[model samples]
Target: MSADTDMEALMDMTRDQLHAAATRYYKKRGPTEPDVALIEYGAARAVFKDYGRAPGWFNRLIAPVLLWREASALAALDDLAGVPRLYRRVDARGLLIEHCPATAWPQARAGDIAYQRLDALVTAMHERGVAHGDLRGGGNILVDDQDRPYLVDFVSRIRRGRPWNLPWNWIFGQLAAADRSALAKLRVRHARHLATADDYERHRPSTGFARFARSVGQRIRRGVRFFGARS
Candidate 1:
């Protein structure tokens, strides 16, 4: 079948049908713990992410929540440019998202326009009360064929509300700041002439809590992935 026909057929399928097809045909991509896969539906390619059986106590406890969090974040993003369109939630543990045909931010010295686009995208996300908490990771920021920036992996996103309230607000604020700082650093490195004074100002050092959170997150990811590999 043609790609378009394939995609339409896949989309037309019932949830159970889609799930079965994905199980049978999806090709595993990234690390196994989260079990990311490149799935070909009717005519389209999608990313299937399953965080159900993560290794380690901390990971197992949090994996389902993170999976839902990411799905919620993507739903909020909806049709915004630079944000992938979420297809469906395969189960409690999995989501199928639009496959971005893009490369990491490090692939090119993306000009000022790309940085501006990224800033605008980030602003839109914040306006909707979502913060991309882990923008420092190169893999999460993608540059498309036209050089527009697309952010992926919303598992670490900070949503607006209680739990995200009070002292948590302080941490969330730092995370938001870090996102801006990361963009600023990118502009400085790839498009120096376009770097604004504000960008430079926002690029200050990460707070202690931000540092600690990042460290803990890294350790968890490493531990879970290592356990997964061993298994």
Candidate 2:
């Protein structure tokens, strides 16, 4: 079967074929984590996060849980523009995702419209009940040649609560605000000349939950996963 050269190409190749043909990789922390690999076929480009390559014990005990988290987030944010598409799930240990063709936020030379578009994208993501929880760091964002924004890396996302879940819903609000605050800070960083008073206000110190999330959420998550694996 021949898939089109567009996003359909992302689903054409099987997992093993893509893995063997991966041209490059990013963020492969340890034997305990997954390998973020780039797979490029004729007209298809994608990223495969393969926890299958992690140690047997780690892969069996913990990888599935993290993989599930990312997959869940991607599923929840499906069809959202800034978020990447989830191509396919490769067993319980890995998943395929769209390879965003854009420059990293830190390195991007974007203008006010790009920043405005980024803010709207974040707002749309929040409306879908997911908080990035890490956009403040800037590594997760990307900008295309047209200066459009893209948010990547769903591993750190925090999901919102149901209607009856008041406490957790409130927490989601704080974390979502953190995402906005992060964006405002980024706008000032990349194009300060266009930064407005509202941007400065939103960039102020975040709520406690948001603050903890932005500051040490990854460390705490890693620690939890490590300890959970031991138990």
Candidate 3:
């Protein structure tokens, strides 16, 4: 990490200033995802997700759609705890997001409270009509110094449908279950002791139909992700 971009230097700068000042990046190796940067200005910091830098048509057309989708999810979840705050849209191609000060879950050592909190957070998120379709991947969870859990990367989220929409509502149910199963998967990986007999029984291998639903859910997720990335 380089020195923080100073406040004085940023005073007269536009939206692009902080992006230009970003000193570190993550996942620059990936071709499919957006460019993520850690932008700092004095003590203020943020994560910038910019698809403007993506290559080819994905940059011009697909990126903004994906950016808007994620931004909408953030807005829907704006008041929810344990999720990053949306600062503002940088442009059609990017977003400025609040920085969660935490270690990635895969690297961070956390107590059972973290898992518990994560479960609650996921539940709260669902109650607000969002299902995070990709938590099983683990890269999107974070644990901070005080053991609170944080969820990031809302690009693949699915919203609950209106009551009159049966099919969409059913899809939402399956995705919501997937979210719960994802939390169970987390326990299996990072805190197996936390999984009780009931947890094992309830979340045991998904039934054939459940498996089908999960597959459908993931397909929808990938469809959304790619559509946004490819837009």
Candidate 4:
């Protein structure tokens, strides 16, 4: 199907239509707050994510907003090559997104070409005013068979308006810098041989906020693992 036609059809689909069209569903492990599944419908596949059943009062309150934020980010970044196409929102709880059959960065042998592509993708995202707040996670960065990078999971994206926007632009700048630093660290870990001295110079030590964010993410991941174990 043509990209435009497929996107149009997806936008028009209802939650019932998505459910009916789904021929197969495989629940996947995800971080805390979201229930994720891979759904196959005819020749197409999509990732279905619902954050309604998250544990704890805090998580329950923030889940919906996070889902919406991700959707908004996807819309703003639709022109990017590696970012997934947003299909449709399923009710207030769920989202159906275009599925890319790619493995996480940690599982793939990310070569120089892959890192270059990833850097370009990140640059593209920043130019469009969206900062993927969690690019440091290996799972959020995927590698295809051709060694191409695909960025996923935008629940923490930060979008800024015009340059004249004061505080927001400043905030966006910091986050964009963080994104670059994260990429530099990733290169240092995965493709150190190809990294330049400037790349090493750009690397900054994680701030308290970054450390706190990582801690919270790790706790959520552990919560998901615990839930899976009990189930």
List candidate 4 stretches off by more than 4 Å: 1-32, 55-60, 204-231
Candidate 4 global CA lDDT score:
0.73
Q: Number of the top candidate by TM-score? A: 2
Q: Write the per-residue lDDT of candidate 1 for residues 114-217, one digit (tens) a residue.
A: 77799899988887878887777466899877878899988778776675368776666666777777788777666778889987765555566666654444
lDDT of 4 by residue, 1-231 (tens): 765665566556665565556555544324345666666544457887766445554344455677888899999999898999888887666798888788889879877888889989999999998887777657789999998889998876778868789977766776777678778878777788977787797665556764554334344446645764454
Question: Between 3 and 4, whose TM-score is larger?
Answer: 3
Worst 10 residues of 3 by lDDT: 1-10
What are the root-mean-square deviations of the candidates from the true structure over C-alphas?
4.4, 2.9, 3.8, 4.8
Give the alpha-carbon lDDT of every model: 0.71, 0.80, 0.77, 0.73
* Candidate 1 whole-model C-alpha lDDT, 0 to 1: 0.71
Ranking 1 against 3 by lDDT, winner = 3
Clashes in model 3: which pairs? 61-231, 62-231
TM-score for all models, in order of appearance: 0.76, 0.86, 0.85, 0.77
- Expressed as tens digits, the lDDT of each residue in 108-225 for candidate 3 is 9889888889989999999999988767667888999899999998776889989999988887888788778777777777788998765666565477767766555457556655
Candidate 3, lDDT over the whole model: 0.77
Error of 1 at 10 (Å): 3.4
Best by lDDT: 2
As a whole number from 0 to 100, the lDDT of residue 55 in candidate 4 is 50
TM-score of 4: 0.77
lDDT of 2 by residue, 1-231 (tens): 343654465666666776777888877746666788888776677889988867657678778887888899999999898789888997898899888888788888887798889988999999998988777768889999998889987777789888999988877887787787888888777788877888898787756655765644476567856774564
